[model samples]
Target: MPADSQPASREKPSPAAAPAAPGAGLSAVQRALRKLGLVRDIDFALYLPMRYEDETRVVRLSDVRDGEMAQIEVAVTSNEVVFRPRRQLIVTVDDGSDTCQLRFFNFYPSQQKQLAVGARVRVRGEVRGGFLGRTMMHPTVKAAGTELPEALTPVYSTIAGLAQPALRREVRSGLARARLDETLPAASDWQPAWDLRRSLNFLHYPAPDVAMATLEDHSHPAWQRIKAEELLAQQLSQMQARNERAAQRAPVLAREAGKESLAEQLLAVLPFALTGAQRRVGEEIGRDLAREVPMHRLLQGDVGSGKTVVAALAAALCIDAGHQCALMAPTEILASQHFGKLVDWLDPLLRSRGLRVAWLTGSQKKKERDEMSAAVESGEAALVIGTHAVISEKVRFKKLALAIIDEQHRFGVAQRLALRGKADAGLEPHLLMMSATPIPRTLAMSYYADLDVSTLDELPPGRTPVVTKLVADHRRDEVVERIQAQLQQGRQVYWVCPLIEESEAVDLRNATTTRDELADALGEAVGVGLLHSRMPTAEKQSVMAEFSAGRLHVLVSTTVIEVGVDVPNASLMVIEHAERFGLSQLHQLRGRVGRGAAASACVLLYSANEGGRVGEAARARLRAMAETSDGFEIARRDLEIRGPGEFLGARQSGAPLLRFADLATDTHLLDWARELAPRMLAEHPQLAQRHIDRWLGTRAEYLKA
Candidate 1:
């Protein structure tokens, strides 16, 4: 279950147990409601129908179309119970125009009484045609001459043991009991034509006259109102979090007067000059670090944009201010890569100042971990770099002032919070989250509104643009020949597989098998290495080291090297079963190449499934890869295919995503909400809080971390 859908109260009862309130105990039905997150009356009111059924008019049996849903009034001519394939109840009915058959695989004793011979009844269900004529496998039966409903009957999304009629009754009761007063200001121009109660009532059971297209597309006035209100609540919560963080204190990082700053010193000694985009974002982070208010910033850059160097500059400023800094990545390979680069750049600089960089990871030996923990506690490690081990309970920072997270979306809310919580008492460390998978524009506007964002839009000079190609798995031999050619040019290759071992469920090439096959095809003269998550830590490190040092001609691995594996000499990346990977993963894997001046290429080797071709969704991902190398474009296309929830990863771990409003189509509403959120909070603070409470409740608290 989702965190928001769990039970409302978890407290134990007192020994003397007070009298229980009406409907307080969790009956089967109540448990079902709790599963739907319908704890309060307002929650039930908002649980609108997923679709509606039209039973307002009856159609003649002769006029019903095959595979179309219809209702007809007819008289039963024969009713019989038969056993064929299985025991079932079959009823033959005839209207004035024609006749039809009704079959029920599961039926109650009372249903037979309702459909007795010579009885008139009304049935509603899908009609299917066969040699025996039209039939409804299981139709809803009702007495004839009964009054038809004036509005469309709603069919709600439900769980087991809860029928639609029972849910309808509870929804009607809750709708009447829920609060429906307006929360927006009276002068707000963004409000739709309909009021809150009218919108909810109409959406629950729309009139028969309403256009089906309007309801299906959610373009009706009532739906517009619901979407607007939902967007407003989200914007308000984000605004509140931003305002609350503004009041908190953090370490004030500033260079000493009349002295060269460490950031400047590091920049002066670098082998390459900083790109304009990197220099601009570096200054932006530098300004934020000098503030007393803790900086909540997101640094977004495309692959190979020189983000690591900019991060190093920020760490230098924090250290120069007489405080320690820590950087965390999601995987050991990425962490080791960052550790190597930081050590190469800042180790000598820090050693000259009586401080050094430290490394920590779960795979480290006990003695090494203990030594690193002590150095962190004593403030001797000016810069600490590692995977999640940096935030482990055993590690403590004496005066940590900056916390940087690479690939921030890969970590959960609690993990990120735990790192921030490592700061000194009554103060927070400035947070800098970095992501190479660029967030789309609308996503940053809504999901990341609380944090300031800096984009590294330009790659450094001398970086080659990678050419992408799509090939069938049948052409594997041709790809091997291309790899040989690249090796002949003294260039390395990365062959990424989707799996490490053969699985009965998924029939794809594994890293180990691919490694052995490639080594044989390329001759023993070409060295091949295999890297995956299941490999021992030291062994994995050794394989990567060999690849980086130009000792290995081809490295076959899983996505463990998706990010932070910077091998400039490696100019070819072949992804086997590329259709099995997400767009972001495909893009990130492709980025591992094209880091050097040599022309690079990424071959997407895909195989058709049992259906004779890959799925349409997978085709779109592959097409996107072949069409462009722009990370932002890929992200936008990805959002369209996968939706926002999966793209966010663990960032919204306990938070409820937008249920009604769409970030793709509701940008106008989002804009209106953004404009009104701060004003409403300033003028009608109570109403603002009440609005958030009604829609988000405790779910909004997740965004605070």
Candidate 2:
């Protein structure tokens, strides 16, 4: 590599210089580069190649093997257009050792003119056996220009109108203009083996002997250094955001005269004792509620781990303080379920003290909604439970102090912010976000870095482990018979289907069809009810109510019932086409059962193998479900399969984003960065800012959001 093809040397720029101006000239190439969100020279330098191709060692045509990529330097002996099976331009090239044919299905007149007879050309492509001993199809052709590159060539992600050669040239130009300054102190113990500039040089132009596996696996020292720096930048940004949020003013819901007694009373009336994990997490929330600074916390618990009871205790504290508390759910069914459960538990205790519980959902009648709104505004409703309807402008809290969001990932950041804004002027409400879908510890560190996290790791006593079994679709009759037997024993059943309406595109069972099939199979011997998202809210609620009350023997529905519908007597759950759902979703569906004293089992019905083969990914998911009932393990597998992007829901600005760090494999590096971030920020703030600018640039705002 030439020294001139290196970045210029200079001190690192300030925050304002992060977004550099685009280079002049080459308008077409620049336009395509802009599509990749690359504008400055630094941006291009950081735009790492997806893969590298070794083209430095040219080989003889006779030595080339089929399915192998090779670079050949030869002189064209003849050029002709052939039209037997298709019109193509065939150019015969010969080196001193042997000869080969270069075939192009789509050729232009300019290409033909360029590949005239007796012209020397260099080509690189995969070799395949053709009519002529060995052929290189659609090989990249160029006039034998200056000597071939002596190092591995980078194959970058490109856009239309930007050929590989063009991209290579522009990237080389960007590299020549890039100037990197050390973002960390020279005395730091966490420094990389190579300097920033040297690392970039080696990454872009590795030696001819460099192993492809090193670069591809990202295990090379250079790549590891880059990953460490990226993780450190993310950690620093999150720490800064946390500090900012902590500085904000919030309402403090200190206990009134008898708030502690009220909490004790509520707990006393519960059917069972609180588990140790629940008590610990509840105390964490309690401490946060007592603070004047807003509480931004995430309460994570596995299904049936009693997160609702913890949240109810938090609400009791707020209610006892004479301030209104609102609990928001992602869906109407979930909201209704929470409302009913809370009323059952706290209505008796709260109603006697002139404190009422209100329910607001999209399905409520206009008059009912108005009444609820008025009660909330007058502060007569000490506790309010609703879906997104609670965040609407029409609803207001007279003395809102705490906002609790359930299934936190299901709601958008904006919606959560909107609910927080509902509090009184100059007072920020405390936020308690709950998620039943437990995230892996490594992921939670980055995903929920801004919030204090407390995990309810223990399930309440009397909760039996769910026995999961994978049943092929061919065993449908047997599974239906088992369900019938359970129903005849007076135990309720839940049959979950992936889809509500039939989809031609997807060859999976639908809820409606499954309901009809079950009805026919049982034939009045069991009471079967149908439930789906498309049905009227009232009708669905009625069916759910009947099922919970044990009037309905079996309820068949879609994934809408996956979350909040709970019945202790519901001992059996049948999931159709379980392979279509993700691991966390499967776990949530299975969580619906095993909530009661009786032993329970979950049946995962999957499509029969195609030609005696099932997809490896789907097989792993089913095997994991059958192997363990640990929600955290399921979450770890989910992260490994779907990655952090989908697992965290949709991408949003200011969210934590990693370009080089793999949460599955680079967790050790993440841990190192997490440990070092605070100290680095405290002692060397400028260097920390530079690191952030180098890795995230304008996108650092995503994590802050």
Local accuracy of candidate 2 as per-residue lDDT tens digits, 1-705: 333223323233322223345553445655677777666667777778898887777788778788899888899999999997999999988988778888999999999987899888888999888776778899988778657777888889988978988777777777677667676655555667777677788888898898778998999988988888878888888887787777888878777663356688898898888999988988888889888888988888899998899989999888877788999999889998899889998888888989899999998999999999999999989899999999999998899999999998887767877898899998889999899988798887876677788999999888998999999989899998999789778899998888624472242335667777888988877789988777799998899989988888989887889898789999999998888888899999999999989899999999857686668888889999999999999999988888887888742434646778898788888888888888877767766776776666766665544
lDDT by residue (tens digit), candidate 1, 1-705: 432233333222221122247546666777777777777778888898999999999999788779999999999999999999799999999998988899999998999999999999999999999999889999998999999998999988999977889888888778887877778887676658999899999998899899999998889999999999998999999989999999999999997888777788898889999999998999999899999999999999999998899899999999999999999999999999999998988999889899999999999999999999999999999999998899999999999999999999999899999999999999999999999989999999889989999999998999999999999999999999999999999999999988634572242345678899999999989999988777799999999999999899899988888999999999999999999899999999999999999999999999999877999999999999999999999999999989999999988887868888899999999999999999988877777887888888778898888
- Supply the global lDDT for candidate 1: 0.90
lDDT of each: 0.90, 0.83
- For lDDT, the strongest prediction is 1
Native-to-model Cα distance after best TM-score fit, residue 114 in candidate 2, in Å: 3.7
Clashes by residue pair, model 1: none
RMSD of each: 4.6, 4.7
| lDDT (Cα, 0-100) at 328 in candidate 1 | 97
Model 2 bad stretches (over 4 Å)? 1-35, 39-41, 75-105, 115-119, 130-133, 159-179, 258-260, 500-509, 650-654
